[model samples]
Target: MDLLATQQCIKISQEIGWTEKRTIETTYEMKLFNDYLLVKKEKFPVTSIFDISFRKKSQTNDIGFLYLHTNSGVRTYFIKEEPFSLIEAYEKLKLERPELR
Candidate 1:
Protein backbone atom coordinates (compact mmCIF):
# COMPACT_ATOMS: atom_id res chain seq x y z
CA MET A 1 0.00 0.00 0.00
CA ASP A 2 1.05 3.56 -0.58
CA LEU A 3 1.84 4.88 2.88
CA LEU A 4 1.28 8.48 1.92
CA ALA A 5 -2.09 7.87 0.32
CA THR A 6 -3.17 5.59 3.15
CA GLN A 7 -2.20 8.25 5.66
CA GLN A 8 -4.24 10.79 3.73
CA CYS A 9 -7.21 8.45 3.94
CA ILE A 10 -6.73 8.21 7.69
CA LYS A 11 -6.65 11.95 8.03
CA ILE A 12 -9.86 12.22 6.08
CA SER A 13 -11.39 9.54 8.28
CA GLN A 14 -10.70 11.66 11.32
CA GLU A 15 -12.36 14.62 9.67
CA ILE A 16 -15.36 12.49 8.80
CA GLY A 17 -16.31 11.15 12.22
CA TRP A 18 -13.64 8.59 13.13
CA THR A 19 -13.30 8.92 16.89
CA GLU A 20 -11.15 5.97 17.83
CA LYS A 21 -7.89 7.25 19.16
CA ARG A 22 -6.25 3.83 19.27
CA THR A 23 -7.04 3.19 15.66
CA ILE A 24 -5.61 6.52 14.60
CA GLU A 25 -2.20 5.62 15.97
CA THR A 26 -2.04 2.31 14.19
CA THR A 27 -0.32 1.87 10.85
CA TYR A 28 -2.76 1.13 8.06
CA GLU A 29 -2.88 -0.93 4.91
CA MET A 30 -5.66 -1.14 2.39
CA LYS A 31 -6.44 -4.71 3.22
CA LEU A 32 -9.89 -6.17 3.05
CA PHE A 33 -9.75 -8.70 5.80
CA ASN A 34 -12.88 -10.49 6.84
CA ASP A 35 -15.55 -7.94 6.02
CA TYR A 36 -13.83 -4.64 6.69
CA LEU A 37 -11.60 -2.45 4.60
CA LEU A 38 -8.95 -1.87 7.24
CA VAL A 39 -7.48 1.58 7.52
CA LYS A 40 -5.71 3.41 10.28
CA LYS A 41 -8.47 5.53 11.77
CA GLU A 42 -11.48 3.57 10.60
CA LYS A 43 -12.65 0.27 9.33
CA PHE A 44 -15.17 0.23 6.52
CA PRO A 45 -17.02 -2.84 7.63
CA VAL A 46 -18.91 -4.61 4.93
CA THR A 47 -22.02 -4.57 7.06
CA SER A 48 -22.03 -0.79 6.94
CA ILE A 49 -20.68 -0.49 3.40
CA PHE A 50 -23.64 -0.62 1.07
CA ASP A 51 -21.83 0.11 -2.16
CA ILE A 52 -18.86 1.81 -3.87
CA SER A 53 -19.10 4.13 -6.82
CA PHE A 54 -16.96 6.55 -8.77
CA ARG A 55 -18.22 9.97 -9.69
CA LYS A 56 -17.70 11.74 -13.00
CA LYS A 57 -15.53 14.81 -13.09
CA SER A 58 -17.52 18.01 -12.63
CA GLN A 59 -15.19 19.80 -15.04
CA THR A 60 -12.69 18.76 -17.66
CA ASN A 61 -9.78 19.97 -15.64
CA ASP A 62 -10.97 18.40 -12.40
CA ILE A 63 -10.84 14.90 -11.05
CA GLY A 64 -13.70 13.29 -9.17
CA PHE A 65 -14.46 11.52 -5.94
CA LEU A 66 -14.74 7.93 -4.93
CA TYR A 67 -18.13 7.44 -3.34
CA LEU A 68 -18.33 5.03 -0.48
CA HIS A 69 -21.99 4.17 -0.14
CA THR A 70 -22.82 3.25 3.42
CA ASN A 71 -25.80 2.49 5.56
CA SER A 72 -25.93 6.06 6.71
CA GLY A 73 -25.27 7.63 3.32
CA VAL A 74 -22.66 8.05 0.64
CA ARG A 75 -19.36 9.44 1.77
CA THR A 76 -17.27 11.09 -0.89
CA TYR A 77 -13.47 10.85 -0.86
CA PHE A 78 -11.20 12.93 -3.02
CA ILE A 79 -9.39 10.45 -5.23
CA LYS A 80 -9.11 12.00 -8.64
CA GLU A 81 -5.41 12.77 -8.54
CA GLU A 82 -4.21 9.18 -8.38
CA PRO A 83 -7.08 6.79 -8.00
CA PHE A 84 -5.48 3.53 -9.05
CA SER A 85 -4.29 2.61 -5.58
CA LEU A 86 -7.74 2.66 -4.09
CA ILE A 87 -9.10 1.03 -7.19
CA GLU A 88 -6.66 -1.85 -6.80
CA ALA A 89 -7.65 -2.21 -3.19
CA TYR A 90 -11.32 -2.36 -4.07
CA GLU A 91 -10.60 -4.83 -6.84
CA LYS A 92 -8.84 -7.06 -4.32
CA LEU A 93 -11.90 -6.86 -2.12
CA LYS A 94 -14.14 -7.77 -5.01
CA LEU A 95 -12.02 -10.79 -5.82
CA GLU A 96 -11.96 -11.98 -2.25
CA ARG A 97 -15.48 -10.87 -1.45
CA PRO A 98 -17.79 -12.69 -3.78
CA GLU A 99 -20.89 -10.90 -2.59
CA LEU A 100 -19.39 -7.57 -3.54
CA ARG A 101 -18.57 -8.87 -6.99
Candidate 2:
Protein backbone atom coordinates (compact mmCIF):
# COMPACT_ATOMS: atom_id res chain seq x y z
CA MET A 1 0.00 0.00 0.00
CA ASP A 2 1.03 3.58 -0.61
CA LEU A 3 1.83 6.01 2.15
CA LEU A 4 -1.48 7.86 2.00
CA ALA A 5 -3.52 4.67 1.81
CA THR A 6 -1.54 3.20 4.66
CA GLN A 7 -2.23 6.28 6.73
CA GLN A 8 -5.91 6.13 5.90
CA CYS A 9 -6.02 2.48 6.84
CA ILE A 10 -4.31 3.23 10.11
CA LYS A 11 -6.81 5.97 10.84
CA ILE A 12 -9.69 3.67 10.00
CA SER A 13 -8.25 0.97 12.23
CA GLN A 14 -7.97 3.42 15.07
CA GLU A 15 -11.50 4.62 14.49
CA ILE A 16 -12.70 1.03 14.80
CA GLY A 17 -10.42 0.26 17.76
CA TRP A 18 -8.23 -2.20 15.85
CA THR A 19 -4.61 -2.81 16.78
CA GLU A 20 -3.50 -3.23 13.15
CA LYS A 21 -1.78 -6.58 13.40
CA ARG A 22 -1.84 -7.89 9.85
CA THR A 23 -0.55 -6.63 6.53
CA ILE A 24 -3.54 -7.79 4.52
CA GLU A 25 -6.39 -5.33 4.21
CA THR A 26 -9.54 -6.90 5.58
CA THR A 27 -12.24 -5.45 7.77
CA TYR A 28 -10.33 -6.63 10.80
CA GLU A 29 -6.79 -6.31 9.45
CA MET A 30 -6.25 -10.06 9.51
CA LYS A 31 -3.31 -11.78 7.89
CA LEU A 32 -3.80 -13.22 4.43
CA PHE A 33 -1.76 -15.80 2.57
CA ASN A 34 -1.99 -17.20 -0.92
CA ASP A 35 -3.88 -20.24 0.36
CA TYR A 36 -6.31 -18.48 2.68
CA LEU A 37 -7.44 -15.28 4.47
CA LEU A 38 -7.35 -15.24 8.22
CA VAL A 39 -10.00 -13.72 10.49
CA LYS A 40 -9.57 -13.73 14.23
CA LYS A 41 -11.31 -11.03 16.25
CA GLU A 42 -13.52 -10.78 19.24
CA LYS A 43 -16.61 -12.98 18.91
CA PHE A 44 -14.82 -14.65 15.98
CA PRO A 45 -12.51 -17.60 15.90
CA VAL A 46 -9.27 -18.06 13.98
CA THR A 47 -10.97 -19.04 10.73
CA SER A 48 -9.84 -18.89 7.14
CA ILE A 49 -12.19 -17.25 4.69
CA PHE A 50 -12.08 -18.12 1.00
CA ASP A 51 -15.46 -17.04 -0.27
CA ILE A 52 -15.06 -13.45 -1.38
CA SER A 53 -16.88 -11.29 -3.92
CA PHE A 54 -16.39 -7.68 -4.92
CA ARG A 55 -18.75 -5.39 -6.78
CA LYS A 56 -19.03 -1.76 -7.73
CA LYS A 57 -22.02 -0.42 -5.91
CA SER A 58 -22.14 3.27 -6.77
CA GLN A 59 -21.36 5.45 -9.73
CA THR A 60 -21.40 8.73 -7.87
CA ASN A 61 -18.17 7.83 -6.12
CA ASP A 62 -15.50 5.18 -5.89
CA ILE A 63 -17.79 3.07 -3.77
CA GLY A 64 -17.60 -0.70 -3.76
CA PHE A 65 -18.85 -3.72 -1.91
CA LEU A 66 -16.98 -6.64 -0.41
CA TYR A 67 -18.85 -9.84 0.42
CA LEU A 68 -17.07 -12.25 2.71
CA HIS A 69 -18.16 -15.58 4.11
CA THR A 70 -17.26 -16.10 7.73
CA ASN A 71 -17.84 -19.05 10.00
CA SER A 72 -21.25 -17.90 11.11
CA GLY A 73 -22.44 -16.22 7.94
CA VAL A 74 -21.63 -13.91 5.09
CA ARG A 75 -20.84 -10.25 5.75
CA THR A 76 -20.86 -7.22 3.56
CA TYR A 77 -18.52 -4.24 3.83
CA PHE A 78 -18.92 -0.98 1.96
CA ILE A 79 -15.86 0.77 0.63
CA LYS A 80 -16.27 4.49 0.59
CA GLU A 81 -14.81 6.94 -1.91
CA GLU A 82 -11.08 6.40 -1.57
CA PRO A 83 -9.94 5.56 -5.12
CA PHE A 84 -11.29 1.96 -4.97
CA SER A 85 -8.14 0.26 -3.73
CA LEU A 86 -10.03 -2.66 -2.29
CA ILE A 87 -11.85 -3.20 -5.55
CA GLU A 88 -8.57 -3.24 -7.38
CA ALA A 89 -7.19 -5.78 -4.93
CA TYR A 90 -10.29 -7.89 -5.38
CA GLU A 91 -9.88 -7.83 -9.13
CA LYS A 92 -6.27 -8.88 -8.77
CA LEU A 93 -7.30 -11.63 -6.43
CA LYS A 94 -9.88 -12.83 -8.93
CA LEU A 95 -7.23 -12.98 -11.61
CA GLU A 96 -4.94 -15.00 -9.33
CA ARG A 97 -7.69 -17.27 -8.02
CA PRO A 98 -10.13 -18.28 -10.69
CA GLU A 99 -11.99 -20.45 -8.21
CA LEU A 100 -13.14 -17.24 -6.52
CA ARG A 101 -15.20 -16.47 -9.55
TM-scores for all candidates: the values are 0.46, 0.35
Error of 1 at 49 (Å): 2.2
Q: Which residue runs of candidate 1 sit more than 4 Å off their true CA positions? A: 1-34, 38-40, 56-63, 99-101
Error of 2 at 97 (Å): 12
- TM-score, structure 1 vs. true: 0.46
Q: Where does the lowest 10-residue lDDT sum fall in candidate 2?
A: 2-11
Residue 26 of model 2 has an lDDT of 40
Question: For candidate 2, lDDT tens digit of each residue in 33-94?
Answer: 44444334323222334455556655755546556666668876555444345335544665
Tens digit of per-residue lDDT, candidate 1, span 1-101? 32222312222233334654442322224444555765545777766776666765656445456667777788766543445555666666667767775
Superposed Cα RMSD, model 2: 10.1
Could you list the CA RMSD of all candidates, in the order they appear?
9.2, 10.1
- Candidate topping TM-score: 1
Q: What's the CA error at residue 72 for candidate 2, in Å? A: 1.4
For all candidates in order, the CA lDDT equals 0.54, 0.45
